[model samples]
Target: MSTDHGDRPVTGVRLQKVLAGAGVASRRVIEQYIVEGRIRVNGAVVTELGTRIDPEHDLVDVDGTAVQLDAGKRYVMLNKPTGVVSSMKDERGRPDLRRFTREWPERLYNVGRLDADTSGLLLLTNDGDLAHVLAHPSFGVTKVYIAKVDGRVSPQTIAALTRGITLEDGPIAADKARLRDSSHGSSLVELTLHSGRNRIVRRMMAAVGHPVTELVRRQFGPLRLGTLPSGHARELGKIELGALLTLARRDSPAEATPGEAREKTRDHGQHDDQENG
Candidate 1:
């Protein structure tokens, strides 16, 4: 059995570090607050860099408000509708995601992006660390999209997509691709990709024969679109969160240890069932 060290001396941590650890803001932003005299320690404004404090003992405040050291992070999935821009702001005064999230208590930003004409599952979070992880390409989070193409896609075009196609940016390949449905002249196809390039799905299809007339993301890693109504937002449940964390951890450069690998294997089976069901 491993021995636990119950009594350990506290270590001094940088004031900015503590604020960042609490998810208040990034370390650089905290420094800006310090330089702006917006940060205080023990009721005295501290404008000095390299200021250190013991989180358990120090009384820290920002802008005259006591800093809560343990703020719970939040993750939300929003079904973004067409016509709303994905960005935080637009000079043209077009509708944006903020209109939908203005009622939320926490400030959140979009994870990845969907074009203004596209619609589907979009992630919003106040947890910067988690957002950074999910947005990083190295994490290899798969985004599954259902694309409605302008024309029928032949088997040869699908094969080219799976084999990888050359675009103006570079060579790109879909992890998985299959025709969801084909009727009349238009076709619906599902494409899964790990890369988050700008307008990747549409460009990839266009590189072949079928240009996408419409696109909607159906899944992101373990999170599925589910029958959740369009233009609605919901928080991810604990089970879904756990599964996504596991998937993210697996895709991390820090390869899963044997124990983690086994856990992921079991979780993968359940995730597949849930996603397909």
Candidate 2:
């Protein structure tokens, strides 16, 4: 048993059992990780196999990556189709996220937005702390987009995207850009960036004289939009959820403890920059 700050009794399961139950690994493997000091509760590494934790409250990390101990939390990936809005409800009567999310019992909200005209991977979740961290551009969760542009994109154009260009908002650069293919007066280009600026990819391509004709976000952080048909949504697999949690933990500042992170998320529920191209 563990006690809260007020000294109230709180029942907790053993650390190894919790990790094993979350599918991090088998109990024996978790024990090995605990023995090797590769696990942390809250922010401190715990090597004792007998340690117990309040699963609903305490944060756990394995090999420095956060683990989602709260099984009730839902992590969903929706390959949003063009013309559907990102909002759960659209007063304007436009098609919205509710179409895809209504099936879940928990009220899941999108971690970020994609322009109605754009389509790709969008994370919908009930985990507010993870959503806040992933949606905030300052945390540097990279997004990759494959774009079909109006003009043939050259190596110089790719170079320029990475070298940085001055958008109306400010100067920005793709962490990486490459021309995937070029033919018949149009080109396929892939760009990776961490920016959450509105219609950023379209603007960036237009800036380089190759306006985007079509765009699809192929990846968001560690999650990939792979073979899920357009407009379809699916619950994240355990491995996928693990990767997302790990990325969120990695991007969050070291000093921000789990309790502080949750409190901050609740205090500023609307703080995440949900908008993106």
Candidate 3:
């Protein structure tokens, strides 16, 4: 089977084969999905087993969940260590992502910036569209962080975080904030926010009179840092990739009108600040 590309006939891989290769399901199960009209290719229901798709260009989904068919695409989670910059390369002779990215053959880039002094759960990918959805200010992807800060944090301080506080740039607030521990002249705070502001967490803590001494991002969207050790990098598992793709699809540029997206930004607050991982 093939698809027409302009005046040329472009040969494509069988739909089931592509899905199976992506570990979506066994070939037999995929065939059943096709027969039941549970699969879609580029928004059109595909019930034909002979349907061939250009995996590179066609969007495939089953039961509204996106299926990534591009084998060349790589999704990596790196537990970046402090002092390493988020950039692929640094012009000022500083440590950068090359140490970890050199292991992959593809020219991967970090999805968003993580402060050189902060660390954890940085995503590196060659998929530009996925990066855009996850990293773009308009998407407001949720992030979770744990911070160790000066002084004891009380329930009031945690409450203040969610209540919103003024920053040098503007007003910001955490979606959720909690005191993990408060003792030994220091406190541990867990903050959840969709803001991508630079050093937002540290600033938020400082606003409550608890300046952060150490910070680490634990989650971004559906991806978690898990037990991955510091300075280590790993490829996302099949399930993880599927969840990430689903998230990307949900916030995809095509899914919202410009006005709607702008409204979402306003409702979620201005997350235009670059993420301080």
Give per-residue CA lDDT, model 1, range 1-277, as digits (tens): 0112346443577888889987668999999998999987866788876677866556676765555454465667888888877766656898877776776798767776777788998877665444555655456678899999988888888888999999998999999999888899999999988886778888898888788888888898889989878888988775666566455544555433334443433222112111110
TM-score for predicted model 1 compared with the true structure: 0.66
List candidate 3 stretches off by more than 4 Å: 1-11, 254-277
Clashes of 1: 0
- Give lDDT for model 1: 0.72
lDDT of each: 0.72, 0.83, 0.82
Q: Which 10 residues in a row give candidate 3 its minimum summed lDDT?
A: 264-273
Alpha-carbon shift of residue 259 in model 1 (angstroms): 28
Give the distance in Å from residue 67's predicted Cα in candidate 1 to where it truly belongs. Answer: 24
By TM-score, the better pick of 1 and 3 is 3
Per residue, candidate 3 scores C-alpha lDDT tens digits across 171-268 of 99899999888888998899999987788898888877989899999998889999999999999987788788888876776644435443443222
Candidate 1 residue pairs in clash (backbone atoms < 3 Å): none
Ranking, lDDT, top scorer first: 2, 3, 1
Clashes of each: 0, 0, 2
